[model samples]
Structures are given as C-alpha cells and as structure tokens.
Target: MKIKLLFFFIVTLISLSANAQTEVADQPAGLEGLISSRTAQRKNPDAKMDGYHILIIFDENRSKAEAIRNKFIAEFSNKYDADVIWDEPNFKVYVGVFKTKLEAQELLNLVKDNYPTAILVKDKLKFPKI
Candidate 1:
C-alpha cells in the first residue's frame, strides 16, 4: 500500500511539473521593428499633453505676478499646482493641470469668488501618472 501511494504521488508530481511549462505567444509582425525604432528615437521623460489651466493672473509687471503666485501658493497649494510663466513682455500666472476644460471650469468656479477674472486656458500639461 505504501509503495502504491508513493508511486501515485510521484506520478502526480511529474504530471504537475509537465503542465507547469508556459508557451510563449507569437509576436505580431513589425512590433519588434517598431520597438527598436522607438528605442532609437527615445521618448521624452517629461511628456506633456493638450490640457487646460485656470488663468488666475496675467500682468505686465513680473513682480506683481510673482506676488500673486506666492499668494496663490500659500492659499491653495495643497489643492492645485501654480506657475508664473513669462510670455514675452507680460507675466502670466496659472494654476492647476486639468485634463479637460470642464475639470478646469470646476476649479475655476470654486476660485471665482477670490479671483473673479479667472478663466480657463488650453495649454500643454504634464502627463498624469498611473
């Protein structure tokens, strides 16, 4: 009986081991070439996409814009991101990286009481992490 039990156990183990082998799926044609070409070209690390931001302040004075940016950072930095961009002669202060105009509008509505002139501006935005 012990001999029969041991033989059954060995047979089960062998069968299980045999079934454990995985088969590799066939790669589609041109996938390897595409991957190689992509690797050669190299992707941008800081990839940006078309998005919207709340234009909080746009002024000709850099100092004024910087001051408003600092104020915004102090008040709402936890909720949103803020930046002071130099667009030629004027300094523009923007907030939030919204993927859609509706999302930007939502935040804009909330902040409208404080910044009455806040409007949504479409621009390149940092890609969100998964």
Candidate 2:
C-alpha cells in the first residue's frame, strides 16, 4: 500500500512539473508591429464611441433648434450635451449621452411630452479635442 502511494505521489509531481511550461510562439516578421499597433488603438480613449443619444428636434432653421435647446436646458435640472449637426437641408438638435438604448428610452419617455418628435439615435460621441 505504501509502495503504491509513493508511486502515485511521484507520478503526480512529475505530471505537474511537465504541465508547468512557458507559452512561447514564433510570429512572422512585422507581426510584432501589427500587435503593437493594435495595442495603441485600444489605448486610445476615443476608440469606443457607441452610445445612445436623443435627437430632440430637427429643423431647417438654426434659431428654432437653438431656442428649443435652451428651453430644454432651462427647464431640466440635469446638464446634457447639446449639439446641432447639419444633416443636408435640416439642422438636428441632439441631447444627452447615454451608454445604452434602455437608458435613453427612459429619458425619452419623460421628455416626449415636451418634444413630441424626440427619438433615440445611436451617435458616436468623442471627447472634444482639448
């Protein structure tokens, strides 16, 4: 019984030692540069831009869009990112940066009464270049 147990312990130790091997791989030339470039891309803060935003209103008149934005800001206690983007003939007023559609939907329900046409849109938002 002792001989069997001793043999079992030796086998287990040998198996464990054999399994503990360092991982190493050889890559083609230029692969290291590609790998570093990929890391650099991930390190950039602005690489990720998928976020849900609410389009408060769209109008051909810039003044109308600005007025709506101001009114919305004045009435709402929370601060929102307000921007006017020209989409062809019309200027779009977008507000708020929500990480998910569910979050935007919750706010949309509340703001819908004020801006009946307000809808959620996926906008790629980046931190303004400082």
Candidate 3:
C-alpha cells in the first residue's frame, strides 16, 4: 500500500540523519553560559535551603500588606528581613528565615505585640547572612 511506502521512506530518512550526527560539544555563550556557570557553582554548595518563617500579616489589599511590611521593618529589633508575598487571594507579610518551627516561634513571640495573629509558616529559607 502507499501508506507502507511512506512509512518506509520516513524511517529511511530518520536512520540516515541519525547516522550523520557528530559528538561535537556545544559552545554556549552569553546568558546560557552564565546560567550554566551558576548551576555548576550551585552543585558544590546549597544556593539556598528550605526552612520556616513567621507570618506577620496576611491581607488581601496591597496597601495594607505594604503598611505591615514597613511597620515591621521600622519597629523590629532583629536582623531579619520582612517581605510581602502575593499568593492567590492575599498578600502575606513574612519576617525572618528560621530553620525550625521552634526558631520561628521564638520570632513569632517577639512580634506578637505588633502582629497579634502572627504564626509560624514553613517556607523556603535563604542562606544565613555573612
């Protein structure tokens, strides 16, 4: 049938192309080179680690979220950084990167006065600052 002939032709072309390949390495440059280099560097050490944090505020409004983040930054006596995360229905204001729930709770206790509903939330934690 004509269908059988077409299938044979396709297989023949694929086999021909497959056999005509070389083992030449790619010369990635610019952005690709930068990405490859960074990934290679990460292989030796952790670029970041998964951890926990304390949620200072969860607000649907962007302005409220910014206000909470700014308030914590101004009043917090610790070295932890506060960041606003946008997740679906709300913006979360998270402060500090703790390796354990206990560590997060310690921070939560300190922030309870300012953020009454503050609680520990597990999330990705960045490497400790040098």
Model 3 residue runs over 4 Å out of place are 1-47
lDDT of 1: 0.86
- Cα RMSD (Å) per model? 4.2, 4.9, 14.9
Instruction: Highest TM-score: give the candidate number.
Output: 1
Residue by residue across 72-98, what tens digits does model 2's lDDT show?
A: 888775467777888989989888888
Q: Which residue pairs collide in model 2, if any?
A: none
List, residue by residue over 22-101, the lDDT tens digit for candidate 3.
Answer: 88977656878798887775564566677888888898999999998887888865478888999989999889987778
User: Which candidate would rank higher by TM-score, 2 or 3?
Assistant: 2
TM-score against native, each model: 0.64, 0.62, 0.60
lDDT scores in order: 0.86, 0.85, 0.83
Ranking by TM-score: 1, 2, 3
What ranking of all candidate models by lDDT puts the best one first? 1, 2, 3
* Clash totals, every prediction: 0, 0, 0
